[model samples]
Target: MKKLELTAQAEDLMKSHSLQGFPNEICGFFYGKTVEGVKHVTVIKPVVNAKEGDQRRRFAIDPLDYMKAEQFVIAEGLEFLGIYHTHPLHPAIPSEHDLKQALPSFSYIILSVQPEKVVDITSWTLNDDRAFEQEEIISNRNVNTSANKAS
Candidate 1:
């Protein structure tokens, strides 16, 4: 597993989506360079909420969305890093269900929009033990493109 790096715009997109999801989990795909020690997130594409639960904002990407994301990455010459989702009113960690579904190689970024007043974002790696271990996500504002990075 590796520590994921979010471009400023990517981070901003995640944060903004989290706010929109408010009481739910905002799910999406992250594309860029996937490697050990350093993972770069160049793009963020939001996915639809498909889970059965209504209380949680976390969304399970639609199958079409997954296919679209994969196609988009290839079209843009980018690598598929992994998926991101928000944990409303909870810690930026994966739940039991999340662990069961996640792959060890992908970077899972969880935004904890909890405590009501403040929102905190964090990243993690799902170890072989199926536990989510915290990882650091450094944001770089130097790169600019069509993606919105403003906070």
Candidate 2:
């Protein structure tokens, strides 16, 4: 599995956003650069959970927001690394619905929000067999200083 390094600020933003949405699943996109097969998340952007049904159990980001995020990341010279969402009262693991819609090369970050608290955070990448495999997340908040300057 590839490693994911996230900035302290990015993680904090995720946690805070998840908490604010409390009991309901909130989602967003993470922007970053990937070097040597490792993804370094530098920024986290919170977006609306444009889901139709039960938000507490499921989350869906608006398509327009996705497009806007892509443009923003491109403008910032960062890659659209992946999306992050809170699993209210659930484990920080991808559910079946998540698996069904999972992107192969993109990262899926899940935050377990329990009782208005961010309990756990885990990153995942889909495998060849169509299953979610956990990706090791390293706290490298300071590593982005020079690592982000790339062609």
Candidate 3:
């Protein structure tokens, strides 16, 4: 099984973002690198949810935001691993709209937020058949610290 590794800080940031967004969905980009075949999230850049209305059930990343995030990733010397979004009151599963918008070779992290808390977090990737497959999440506080020390 492929693994998506996240530093404790990254997880905390996502949780905080989700909670802050509350009844509205929040979206962002995940910046990281793949080490030994494991995708390690080093940074998460939260962006405004550009969906015009009824944001409680959906979220969108503005094209300008996407471009800026890409540039930021390059400037920081990190890869644009994928996207992360909150599912206000929904489960941490991709929706039909997500399926249609997903791009191959990118990881998608979904967080289920209820009221003022995040209930779950899950990572996913599209397979050959264009179906979503869950990726294993490995949250470790030491991973990023050790990697930075090696640098």
Per-candidate TM-scores read 0.84, 0.90, 0.92
> Compared with the true structure, what per-residue lDDT tens digits does model 2 show for residues 85-135?
988888998988999889888999999988857989999998888788899
The residue pairs found clashing in candidate 3 are: none
TM-score of structure candidate 2: 0.90
- Candidates by TM-score, descending order: 3, 2, 1
Off by over 4 Å in 3: 144-151
Q: Candidate 2: deviation at residue 87, Å?
A: 0.8
Cα lDDT tens digits for candidate 1, 1-151: 3466777788877778777877877787788876566887887877767777784744676687788777878898888888888888887767887887888778788888853432677777777887788777777888652353322
lDDT for each residue of candidate 3 in 32-150, tens digit (9 for 90 to 100): 89999899898778888889989998888889889887887789788889999988888999999999999998999999999878999999999999999999999888855212210
Candidate 2 stretches greater than 4 Å from native = 143-151
What lDDT does candidate 2 reach at residue 17? 85
lDDT of candidate 2 at residue 149, scale 0 to 100: 13
Q: CA lDDT of 41 in candidate 2? A: 88
